[model samples]
Target: MQHVPFPRSVRQKASLAFILVMLLAVGNVSIVQFLLREGDGVAATLNVAGKMRMLSQRMGLSALALHQYPGLPDLAPDQLPTLFDEAHDALRLGGRAFGLDIPAVPKALSPQLLDVRQAWMRQQLAVDALARAPAGDRVAVEALLRANTDLLARTETMMDSLVVQAREVQRRALYGAYALFALDLLLLGLVGWVVSRRILQPVQALARQCRALAVGDYAARSDLPPGDELGELGRALNDSAGRIERLLRDIEQEHAALADAQSMFNGLSDNTVAGIYMVDESLRFIHVNTRMADMLGYPQAVLADGFPLHQVFTGADYETVQAQAMERLSGRATRTRYECVARRGDGEPIELEIFGSLMSLHGRPALIGIMFDITERKRAEASARRAALVYAHTSEGMVVTDADGVIQDVNPAFTAVTGYSADDVVGQTMNVLSSGRHDEDFYRVMWARLQDTGRWSGDIHNRRKSGEEYVERLSINTSYNADGSVNCRIGLFSDVTEKRRREASIWHQAHHDHLTQLPNRQMFEENLRLSIEQARLGGTSFAVIFLDLDLFKDVNDTLGHEAGDQLLRLVGRRLTECVRSSDLVARLGGDEFTLLVRDIEDPDDIFPVADKILDSLSQPFALGQQTVQISASMGAAFHPRDGGSDSELLRAADLAMYAAKEQGRNHFRVYAAEMRESVQVRQGEFARGPDPASAPAQSG
Candidate 1:
């Protein structure tokens, strides 16, 4: 049994009783003293009234003597004035004693005092006049006697009224003293009764109950009345007793429940997958389940020998665990979950995820935890992280689209190539990047191929964010669901616009002159062969004109190769202008050019083109500050009429050109079978080192 306790010390109750006793005694003494003081005041007032009466009678007697001894001057003056002054003093003293001019005087006494004072004043005045009159003046004496009579009668009445008031006051004081004594007796009796009932009896009952509680009788109660301090205390004691009793019952119930819980905990500890453990405030393992011991690779008996928490982890991990435990113990957190490497008894480290909470065990602060093995999960997460890194950082642009060809995601390289950020292209159709260069039929065919093969690889022309056109080498593959339906598409591509431009540049460099940008010898020969082949197939003859600049070497010797190059460029431009757009104009080596005219109706048509070449070269060329005039020696050969092969036609044109030069340069000549002899003689002269003065000059 248990019960509440009240702090009703015996010493405290005794002290309160003593204080009440002392208060009662002091009250009685005070009342007695007050009555005595009131009685003394009434007696003093009665004495003052008697003195006033005596003084007034004395004054009257003195006035009578003055009236009787009308001629006794000495006695009349001195005695009369002395008696009047004495009476006035006695009257004022009486007024003061009766509380006149003070708030204590009764309202009924005021007018009586005033009347006596007036009468006394009148008598004194009369007495003074008599004293001042002639010593034997009987009339003055009679008048003084009369005034003294009136004054005596009024003073007598006033004294009588005061004596009556004093007697009444004395009687009332006696009555009051009796009443106060009675009240003191009653109060003392009441105080004793109250102390006995309110304080003493209630306190005694509380003391008995306290004793009973100490002896384990929890059912004892004071049950005092309310509306007093003692009653409040009783109620408090009763409440405390009830709470204590309930607490004891709860302890008994909790003890039984704890026994049951311990049994259940042991059963679960042997079978549950998780390892459960408890550590005391000093970080020493106080309890470990069978599973916990097995998880740590320790025999249950050895672990039960109380291992320190530090032995279960590496040094750094133990330190971290200690810090976290301290935080929880200090109330920063109630529970926490964290990962740490735990060492087994065999000294092998194992990764674990621990869910821990702060709790009280056996009335001491402790930590309880449930640990799970997480090594495999951590390894898988690390592998996934590596794959994510590669996907994020690869250089090739990649885009993922849904089955409907709407973009779902893009990598950084995609933004770099297409200038469209993931924010711009996600959820947008793939057509957003299309250059609109491919017609519907082209896309229809492309989609057909894709659907059939599940892949497509080709060059695609696309538009960028800047509206600039670029080519990409794109390869796309389709992904399918388990049902073989298309799920999504992945595209990998690289911008090849620069690559295509570089390839074009290399081809141009192979076939064109670097200086004049005109077709060089290789291109000219190929075109000539094609023209000869066309003539044979169509049965129509075309013309090949061979032209050379006259005196061109003199210009190079006079100026420089740079100036010669400039002259050649101007010549090439003029020659291109002279030929029809359908014809081919090629620079066949230094200062020599060939024109291929196709679809010639007559052989005479070749002569006008040849004449135009000579005429254009005859114009002045501005080479730097020098305006130099130059001309060309032109020769024409009709294919089929001249030999059919490329070499045959080119030789015929060359021989005719030398014939024009031999005929004296800056003129055109058509090839004939007769010029063959002169061309042979000139070729023999050019091969033997012909003189510059005689040989034809090539144009600059």
Candidate 2:
């Protein structure tokens, strides 16, 4: 019988246990039966052989007994009942052995067992024959014994064959049992395979979940029917996968948010008002934002892919900016500002102001530049500067100030006129220059006038830091606020301190001949007015004296007007010395001169000065080489006594001088209004002839 390997659980438990019990029962029963059969058969066979041998020996002894006890004759020779009994018993044992061998022996050895049975029978027959024969038949008994021996040999061979056959049969039966065991094991495996289906079902489901996860099927799950640990594990897998799906979704959402933020930052960088650009270590433009692109009239989308920035900036300028940015990065400088011209897309040039700084992007050195158009602002500033320069070089002093009378600005002309540098006066109150020549009340009046009329003009004296004073022709105006408030005051002025001095100089040149450099008659009369002011103020009386150089025109007709003029200068100097420093001297015309004496109170007080002037002219004049003589006729004017004005005084004095000339030459005369009856008028104006003193000189 084949053995089936037992399954550890389920149906195999009871059935295999039962089968094991049954098989063990059967094996024990069969083993006991076989043991008993084999041992009894072997013992019965040995008993049979022993019984046959004993039967033969007994027959021999009986025969020998018959031979030795022939006289007794009680033992039957052919049919001894007792001997048959022993023989029968021996045959019964042999038959029992045959019966045992029939059950225990193999079929292949049945003949050999049958032969042993037949040989035992033949030996029994032989022994019976020997017992029936007479005692003389000893030869027959010997033959029978000999035949039994041969039969025994044949029986031993049969027993040996049966033993070998039985052992061979036992081996075959053992092999059969093992074969049946293999078949039982094969059947159990088939049943086990069917049993494993329930288990493999869950495993297959787990495999599907794993496959789904591998293929990114986050929704896919084992979904195994719930029962045991496998099912719970499947559910856990589904939960884990769900969590992974959520994580993936979260990751995706974060990625999108990051992308959106990056886009926003990019937009701001591109669209900022300030141009932005980045340059790499090679000094090539690495990135350019929209504003930077727009600065050069380029679209960002088209130009963000960098070009060499040096194409726009000369290499020298680029390097300079690079160096400066590097310096700033190294903390070498505070701040640097640069401006340059940049070309547009159309090749037109415009001014740009650039500020560059050092920074790193993506872990590499880069220059960040901010630039803008400064063209208009730069041009306007340049124009304002030119106007300022023009104002600085102007010929007249100018002060520009706000409405508070504070100096906001000044020019070089102001510095020259005021003898102050711009630094000394800027921002100071305009009152810093007030000369105090004008009263505070006057300034109040001026301010009131300006506020009322929006402007005021006057001659004001202002002082300098050096303590020098100057007169300014000042015109000040108030600049108004939009709301009509006074916002600023502007004052412009010219220094006129030298005005009176220049006037006196021109007056001297106009009345006198250029050659003699002395006051002429016109000025002599004008001096009479001043002399009267002196006489009235100082309680002094002064005379107007007129003299003509004698014979002065004759030399001019002979030599030239130049030589005559020279002689006139000589005469003018001689007359000039004859007068006191407080007196006035002038050349009336070509040969005439006038004098006004100051501080003469009495009428006799004038003649001495007149006589001395005449005496000085009587001297000879040395004209280079020729000596010439000249004489003088003098006229005098007295304030209040001669005439009320300079004209009246000159007229009275000239008539008196002509009278003196009529008396004698080289003399002086005192003016008297009573003698004026001899004067004549023509063209309705006084035709006053030569001086009265000179008329007498002409008479002489």
Query: What is the C-alpha local distance difference test score of each model?
Result: 0.77, 0.69
Candidate 1 per-residue lDDT over residues 133-210, each given as its tens digit: 876687887777777678667767766776677778777877877886787688667667756766789889989988
TM-scores, one per candidate: 0.39, 0.34
lDDT, model 2, position 411: 79
Error of 2 at 173 (Å): 99
**Model 1, position 140: C-alpha lDDT score:** 81
Per-prediction tally of clashes: 9, 22
